[model samples]
Target: MRDAIKQLAESRSECTTRQTWYSALFSYNYPNSSETLRTVLDLLITARNEKTTQLQDTGLDPAVRARLQDEVSPLIHAHLPDPIVSEKGAIGIKAESVYQFYECDAGRAAVVFVSEILTAVTTELTHTGSIGYPLTTVLASAVGVHSRFLQASKKQVLDDLPI
Candidate 1:
């Protein structure tokens, strides 16, 4: 399941590029296909349901679970493209706040902040210095990767924008 989630994340990253390319094709082709749009919406709904179910089964602490869910839910809501197909073949995937969360310095900062908090909590819970140091290092590395991801996304958005 973890692998599946990781793959999904990776696929989503690649799909962003495909989306840009397809937007141009879509604008020229079938610009109004409610049926096709509906299929995408249905798939999103199914994915969300599965994720929710997985979260429920994880048995994480209620507070932690709530916080994670709260943080992720808005991103899901914001990023889920409206089924409306534009003339430019844009699927109306407008979620500037959510996009910014994955594309800006502030967003990277938030990830680092959360990672540090988690590291501290883990350190306190286990009282095992060995584990804490490695976890901290991993979290720090994640912050760097996330920052790079955001930078690339920002560049892509800028490239796609109309002058």
Candidate 2:
């Protein structure tokens, strides 16, 4: 019947839309290249240091402190990509570009933590909506948060390291 055919077409269209949305969300969530992660990490480190210094200064008001903390917290949290290890026990996230800084256990832990966060973020985004604009916006927000968290974490690790 025409009604049945129409229903099938509609379902197919919905399915396609969902797929597209899912793909976009995942792509944004997982940086295709380690370079992307590295870039984000660098920015995060800078932000973390700046925020920490601001916090330490005596003149900052409570509102300013709150804002700075909010801005820096997410970047510190998002740097959690685990290193990809080879069969020979060589550990690295990418071979050439976006080299991971895993000289110590703290760095390795940061990567693992961020990776877990990414997975959780993707799942949360998928469940809250049907891969639509609202979902995309939410994912974008999460990406920003993760970026900040990763930066802060990196700074902490670097600070702990002996020069």
The candidate that wins on lDDT is: 2
Superposed Cα RMSD, model 1 = 16.4
Candidate 1 lDDT, tens digit per residue, 1-163? Answer: 2223233433444454422211111222332332343344445556655657767766678887786565346325423321122232223233332211112232333343343344344444445354567766676566556546544423222221110
Error of 2 at 21 (Å): 26
- Estimate the TM-score of every prediction: 0.27, 0.32
TM-score of 2: 0.32
Steric collisions counted per model: 0, 21
- Return the TM-score for candidate 1, rounded to 2 decimals: 0.27
Superposition error at 34 for model 2 (Å): 2.2
| Clash pairs, model 1 backbone | none
**lDDT (C-alpha) at residue 32 in model 1:** 39
Candidate 2 root-mean-square deviation in Å: 18.7
lDDT of 1 at 103: 22
